[model samples]
Target chain A: GPKVLQIPSHQIIDMGQMVTLNCDPVSNHLYFYWYKQILGQQMEFLVNFYNGKVMEKSKLFKDQFSVERPDGSYFTLKIQPTALEDSAVYFCASSWGGASAETLYFGSGTRLTVL
Target chain B: QQQVRQSPQSLTVWEGETAILNCSYENSAFDYFPWYQQFPGEGPALLIAIRSVSDKKEDGRFTIFFNKREKKLSLHITDSQPGDSATYFCAASGQGTGSKLSFGKGAKLTVSP
Candidate 1:
């Protein structure tokens, strides 16, 4: 099965500090996505990127958040000046295409705790 | 607003019994529905899926019964086992919506063997 690998299974950062979460998506995957999940809550979509550009973003994608996959490298999500409410598990997922039926391969997720 | 909704926040079923999980969606544009299974400390994985065109889809012990008219669906796990214990999330997407999936607050299932 295809695998999406997330770096640093857990991260503890102080509020107002910047944090970067890294993801190594499936090699052949072209579309990348980041989702946030709080305990016992739904997985909320943050943003989706394709062709080096952001395709769509949800309200949860705050202005402080940014995503980039520099030169075909690891897709990264960087959050500046993190807030306490930003504490959640962030899962990275990738798909070969953006079609409705395309399957998404997700990483185990990075548990970010903003203290 | 939640585009997808699921019932029974938590359920416990005994082994060999059938467990049914219900889901509904608010968007009429959604045509693709997928069920994802997640265990503790792990990301959700695609367990089974069905399209709006199909009324039923079966895969081994797992089955999906869809009602396009009512905008509802259900996943039935027969002959459940302890390993089947996990949180199941119902997700929806549509052609015009690209691949962004709207997921429901998952239903946690506990299978007692």
Candidate 2:
């Protein structure tokens, strides 16, 4: 079965430091997304990427957050000067094209802890 | 605005009973609805999904009842087992390319023996 893979299962970083979360989407997938789930909170959409460009983004995707797929590279979420509120489980997912078009494959997730 | 909303933050059902989770969305453009199940320490996995064209979809012991007019949907798990206990989230996606799913707050279900 096709699978999405994320790196660094868990990370603990200090406030004001930078962190990069990486995701390797399914080989043939054309759309990638990032979601954040804080403890005891709903999973929030952050951003979506397609064709090596950001297609759409949500308010939660702050100025500090950035996503990129460099040369068919892994989709990545980078946060500069991480805040305490940034602590959450970050999930990376990929879909064939559209949600109604195909199912999405999600990675195990990268748990970020800001201390 | 929260596109999707779920009722009863949590639910408790006896083993062998049926568990129903409710969800509603305000966006008419949302044509895709999917239910996801999550256990502790793991990302949510797709349990089932339904398109707007269908009113009912079933697989195994899980079923989805969708009301297009009312903009509501429900997930029913039959013969609920203790192992079926987990957090379930109903999500809706807007029109177009991976447009970022809007998820409900989630329902924590517990099936007791």
Candidate 3:
């Protein structure tokens, strides 16, 4: 089974600070995604990235949120001046292709806590 | 707004019994449905998936019954074991959505031995 690794399983940051979550997707996977899930809530789509560009994003992806995979190293999600509502577990996923039928593999998730 | 809906926030079934989890979607464009199982402290793992062209898909003890017209589906696990206790999420994606998935609030199942 393929695995996606997320760094910093738990993070606690001040509400006005910046936080970055990193992801290591499967070696051969191309498309990458970020999803947010609050405790006891459904997972919500944040954004998807492909070929160094944002392919699609949901409304939950706020203006303060950004993603990048600089030099194919790690897919990172950065939230600047985070809000209290930003506290959630962020899961990273990747697929070989950005198609409806492609299977997406997910990471364990990075739990972000804003205080 | 939730594009996908799942019933029975939690379910309890005896070992060796069958457990059914129901799901419905509001979007007709959704053509691919995949079910994922998640345990505490772990990521969601793909259990089984069904395409719009198929009404049923089975793999081992897990089966997915899909109704395209009604935009509903159900995942059935037969011979349930205590190890089967986990949260199941129903996700949907459509053409041109760039493979972005809309997931339902998961149904947590507890298989008692």
Candidate 4:
């Protein structure tokens, strides 16, 4: 099974501080994604990246959120001046292709808490 | 608007009994459906999936019955075991949506031994 690794399983940050979540996707994966899940809600798609560009993003992906995979290194999600509503578990996933039929491998998830 | 919906938010079944979870989608473009299973403190993993073209798919103790015309599907887990207790999420992706899956709230299953 392919593995996607997420750093900092749990993160606690002040409401106005910046935070970055890192992901190490499968070595051969081409498409990367980030999803957010509240304590009792369904996992919602935030954004998807491919070839250095954002392919698609949902409304949940706020203006303060950004993603990048610089120089084939770790895929990172950065949130500037976090808000209390940003508190949730973030899961990173990757797939070998951009097709709907392609299987996605997800990381354990990083639980973010804003105080 | 939740594009994908799952029913019976929670279910309990005796060991060796069959557990059925149902799902339906509103989007007509959705062609791929994948069911994921998650244990507490862990990420969801793909259990079994079925394409719109197929009416049924089976993998060992798990089977997916799909009704393409009805835009609905169901997962049946037979011979349930305590280890199978977990949350099951039904996800969908359309042709143009690629792998950006829309997930359901999930159905929590408990297997009583």
Candidate that scores best on DockQ: 3
Native contacts conserved, per model: 0.64, 0.60, 0.71, 0.71
- Docking band of candidate 1: medium
DockQ, computed on Cα atoms, for candidate 2: 0.66
Q: What is the lDDT of residue A19 in candidate 2?
A: 100
Error of 1 at A63 (Å): 0.5
Candidate 1 global lDDT? 0.94
Candidate 4 lDDT, tens digit per residue, B1-113? 98999999999999999999999999999999999999998889999999999999999999999999899999999999999999999999978665599999999999999
Candidate 2 lDDT over A20-41, as tens digits, reads 9999999989999999998956
Q: Which pairs clash in the backbone of model 1? A: none
Local distance difference test scores for all models:
0.94, 0.91, 0.94, 0.94
Instruction: Give one digit per residue, the lDDT tens place, for model 4 in A2-75.
Output: 89999999999999999999999999999999999999469899999999999999999999999999999999
Candidate 2 segments whose C-alpha is farther than 4 A from its true place: B96-98
lDDT of 4: 0.94
lDDT of 2 by residue, B1-113 (tens): 87899987899999999999999998888899999998988788899999999999999999999999999999999999999999999999857534678889999999999
Better of 2 and 3 by lDDT: 3
TM-score ranking, high to low: 1, 4, 3, 2
Q: Write the per-residue lDDT of candidate 1 for residues B39-87, one digit (tens) a residue.
A: 9999999999999999999999999999999999999999999999999
* Model 3 regions lying over 4 Å from their true place: none
Q: For candidate 4, give the docking quality class from DockQ.
A: medium
lDDT of 3: 0.94
